[model samples]
Target chain A: MPQLALNRLRERGSTERAALDALLDDVLAGTLSTVVDGKPWVVPMLFARQGDRILLHGSTGAGALRHVAAGAPAALAVIAVDALVVGHTTFDSSANYRSAVVHGTLTPLPDRERAEALDALSERILPGRNAEVRPMTRQEQAKTLVMAMPIVDGEFLVKTRSGTASPPDEHTDAWHGVVELRTVALDPAPAPTSTAEEVPRSVLDFAGARVLA
Target chain B: MPQLALNRLRERGSTERAALDALLDDVLAGTLSTVVDGKPWVVPMLFARQGDRILLHGSTGAGALRHVAAGAPAALAVIAVDALVVGHTTFDSSANYRSAVVHGTLTPLPDRERAEALDALSERILPGRNAEVRPMTRQEQAKTLVMAMPIVDGEFLVKTRSGTASPPDEHTDAWHGVVELRTVALDPAPAPTSTAEEVPRSVLDFAGARVLA
Candidate 1:
């Protein structure tokens, strides 16, 4: 991306957009933050990415949505959860973290582009999801609105950092900090009674694990 | 809670402030989002709770921090990766989710209040960690800046919409959309050959899981 093209993510100063794109792909929704008259407001919302354009939506009367629709400048973002880092250098130095820091403006998408944005948002969370849901009703569709922003090249920066909290180099304590990680699997997918020992590969393929240490 | 207090979270014109508070108590630091110009930025960070004050911090010149200090509205959020719900619903209808949203003005701690904010931020990540490292070096303390926001009751809302995605009413499918979650851990502490099974409870408790998932 060119210099003017990378306007939003200038502080990150990176050459790779793919790294941040992958992180955004795995996460479904994002939390939006903006200042209105000096007071701050945050909202959690769903989103989608089409090439470099990020699509997000809200109900007709959603205050934040309406506020931005009225032309207020707004900020939108997404994040992935990683583990908590508790370091060994200092018993008290433990930090938990993951990837973050990509930004873009929230602009009202045109009606002609609405369907694509919605589809993108749905697919971002669950593949093939649009095919499954009843199509958006005309009235429902009318009540909702979508916005898109390009997250291309220099427009965004993706930062992913990990490691336990470490004591300053000067401190040499006997104990170390810890990063606690916990992983949980779906209740073992029970085999169908008629299947005997045959287990569905889907069950084997999709297991749950939540690790945060 | 009163409607005015809930600010924008009033769907039924009521507040779920209690649940929201509990979520905050256990919310990890990795869930914060910010904005720059028109784009949204997401970042995983360190956090702490001191009474009603929620603390967060980073390199003073970090892109996210710089943006916030410049008077851009910021939000500190805590999302709990909750449960997996399975319905007789198809993969299309199956759904799973977590909960959290915190909106607040992000301001640098005045030079005089820096120590308190940093203390709270460090302790929040690991319960007994505040005093383990060398006391914040004058330079380290100067280099790091903290932001504090009150846990307002009304502006808070805890949303829980999760389960196996199913048809509107009841249409059982042959294969339900069973969700499997995956988390990757960062670096792990080296295990010592000299020691046998004698390990601290914290290390032993989460040993089977990733060291920094």
Candidate 2:
């Protein structure tokens, strides 16, 4: 439960737990940072949040995930980019984003919990997907490694940059503000043999209520 | 110049140097992971490729960058999320993405090269922005810390997953294909006091060629 100190850009760092959860739940992907053997690695992995713990799954044979399960230190970073803040001056320009960094050791999930965790991940990424897809067989489950890292009390950082630029330079009379961007799901492309008339409801639901700029 | 070994998901790992360069050049943002004082940190930063080195700049007072400058080992991961591959089964669903992971130490850029690096970054993120915006003043340059990590011969990995799932489950009759996703710049919102009638050509150019879906 120790707090992770923000040693730089303290003004932009937020300790709000809601902000952390919101950022984690919204982003679908993140890079997992950990050391393997003697080399450092940043591995990209899909992640979903379950209560106070973050769920991450990968091939059971992945060495990086195995090391984390064995109690190696790790950090998972999820970033939701909002827009590019174009400032009147190059020095003042910055990207508008909501980023969360969580640090903890991952533990392997039990069989029963792992099943639910897999469904939870599907639901998070593609809502209503658990019902549309076939259940995972035992052999498939065995080959998958499901792990969770507690959203430790203070070992995280949430930083966000939104709204207009911090007042443009006085000498420059150029325009400045955020050019908003949103990630909306595009129409699904059905496989060659599939007969579905369109993307299923689950896919539609994922793009629901997008914050339009 | 030795190749970094692929220790996990060997099937998804790619060793082609061109693939690494292409992924790095296309993605605008990446997380820089480094260890400082025995604690791991994954800090998000904007990056651009210049020949054999990756250019990254931040505030001079930032601790994470300072550690990298002091020769702490670092990995910069750039990922371009291409799509979400929805499968007939929950277990088969996965995302389509191109990711590049580079491992190396960072060295601070000297004065002259630092200026060029800043312009290179601007051009990469916002093409033609260097000419569109006012020049960075000397004092502004002094407070900004620019650094580069050499793109070693084989100390990098590029992995990409595109197209439909690896043949869906035979028993399930669900649709399958990638739900493409792209990051396109939105209309620029000029500040309330600004006089520009429309977004600059550079901003428009960035989004012009997007494959609208």
Candidate 3:
């Protein structure tokens, strides 16, 4: 498949398919944008990448999801800001981030695949979660809407910025460097209605993986 | 201005203006979406909230920026996931997040206010850096494009989900709770080109404010 060309800031664009997949695997949520009656509409959504297609689940009554179901073209952008770069001047200051945008028309998952798709999304949020909980009831599955968008090569773009600030043109006493940013998962708090006294393995693993060492 | 009605999930919608401002102030970046020749295009952008408007700066040569500058309506979405809420079943699992979507036509800041606007953007990223660094040169200013969108009542929507997962109708021994998430700023790494050996107060302050206590 043809690769989507990066028209601006060509230096930051990456052509490797591995880079695109890596970015998608790292970020959990993104904003889905589409046009509604000639005006742009966008909303934040939680998604998981399943092979070459991204899966999104929501209530069937959701307005944005319903609009996309009606055949509107959509775009999903996932961006993770890694650090804040400080330079000698404000113009040179910027953030280090990994961003990916995928464009496609979403298709509602067939009834036979809806359960598996929901499990894919659940696994992304909390690995090993399906085995720990009960299966989704038929009524629950009916209320949920699952959609997938193909991650075609020509319809996607990935850009990343990393490392320190640009080397200063003229060295001065001003401080210049980068402050790394990371998203950490803190301790779990049990819900009042839960009968479970012990934290599950999935929760423990997620926190262990996400906490700053 | 009239408030834009929430067409779905009204319980998650926030009517308070303060909530909108707070979400914008907390998130340093968001996805900006607009229609380019009837196709949806979106890009992650670094932005800062300045009173009732959000300030965005980019190169004049950026294609997405140029499209918005040509009078297309744009929508900016800022979302921060606060926690992963675990439920008894996959259907009940969800994320806790604070999200705000602002819709408006972005207007490029006039030359007279461009400097001040840039300062505002800078201050948001690094509160005290503007005072420590030299002013932007005219040449640097000429290449940058700064734009602002008004946060009017009818054009914006704020939604948030927080606290624990929903109470289970049937008590189960399975674990249920939330794994809180936070964006943390780590230690600063100085660039090789810097002549200064000591980190500045601004960097220290930013790290102090963002690090998990």
Candidate 4:
């Protein structure tokens, strides 16, 4: 088991999983971790969660993904946060974070749920993204594999390690410190051409919302 | 070797690593991926790099980073932008993304380098973050284990997958698409009531200069 230290919600169970879903809903992609040869590997992928499952779709011909499709159990972990707690000591050091660890088998979506799942994956990150971009034809969908994982099997933690860093017993000579933190969305970037004036709804809706770090 | 799409620069060599450094100069803590049980595990960390090595410090007494001291190889990947790739097919789908992956064996840092590295790590992210936070005492530094990995041995890549997504192979049904991007920065929360207000010079400099997502 991995050693994790969190202050807000110490347990890792169903609540954590729900927190993972909410974070996933707020962002488009996360750093997916998998181990090969006892060495860790990570890839960024766009994903969609349907009920208890996570839908992951990549290239129909990505060689890296071939490793996952070939009987590999990956740990799909995503960590998003509202803040980072820089405590004085290691014990007190923590983050106000939301994360999920999904340990399970992944098989590429064959001819089945590929199309709909891909659409879900696209739209989940950017609402109305699917309609604005090119739609996949049946032939393309058949070749694309949409991998899904059951959410119940995954263990997630939604808690925060916030507050001052408590110094260890031996360190009395130093000053305590902290980073006053927050992440606020800035105004949208204007298009290169002045006439391209309208902003997408995705921007309008998420422009000022709080997001994971 | 863990499988990953090779087309993007984030997975390939050192140029991307330096670029990643320049990017991180803007943000402090980032999500990190570590390998455990032949599966990838992610933990958020505050890190800094010098020469060919990346510095990762863990509490000697607590948390998941204990795994690093116990001999786990982690791939530290950082992503700065998440843009909608206006592509037609899943294969052509891309994003205007800037990600850097550094893979190396985490080794215990020599006792001599601990304090300097810690200072570097703090300053790299927030410029004067180290000054605001309490300074590390000798005993505390002694107890903490700093992991160092050569940034050179690792492959780095930065993929610019931005542009319109047209359905693969067929140009006839292509619908025009655009890359819609957004990035956020904080509103600069002030210090708590007790602590004196600290406006770091670099931060003030950052404020005056325009930063585009």
* TM-score for each model: 0.68, 0.91, 0.94, 0.75
If both were scored by TM-score, which would come out higher, candidate 2 or candidate 3?
3
lDDT of 1 by residue, B1-213 (tens): 001111233442324666665656655443565555454455555465667766766666566567776666666755443423332222223234345666666667898898766655655444444444455656657766567766777655566544343333434333444454434333335322112233334443444443222
* Candidate No. with top TM-score: 3
Better-scoring candidate (TM-score), 1 or 2: 2
Report DockQ per prediction, comma-separated. Answer: 0.23, 0.41, 0.50, 0.25
CAPRI class assigned to model 3: medium
- In TM-score terms, candidate 3 sits at 0.94
Global CA lDDT of candidate 4, please? 0.54
Q: After superposition, which runs of candidate 2 have C-alpha atoms over 4 Å from their true positions? A: A1-8, A196-198, A207-213, B1-8, B207-213
Q: On a 0 to 100 scale, what is the lDDT of residue A23 in model 3?
A: 82
Where does candidate 1 stray beyond 4 Å? A1-15, A69-72, A88-98, A107-113, A129-143, A163-213, B1-14, B30-44, B59-74, B81-100, B103-119, B130-142, B162-167, B170-188, B191-213
Report the lDDT tens digits of candidate 2 across residue range A99-203.
778999989898888788878877777778888867778877777778899997789988887777667548565766667676666666777756667677887
lDDT (Cα, 0-100) at B117 in candidate 4: 74
Range of the 10 consecutive residues with the lowest summed lDDT in candidate 3 chain A: A1-10
Sliding window of 10 residues with minimal summed lDDT for model 4 chain B: B1-10
Instruction: Give native contacts recovered, as a fraction, per prediction.
Output: 0.11, 0.49, 0.70, 0.17
Clashes of each: 37, 0, 0, 20
lDDT order of candidates, best first? 3, 2, 4, 1
Highest-scoring model, DockQ? 3
Whole-model lDDT for model 2 versus the true structure?
Answer: 0.73
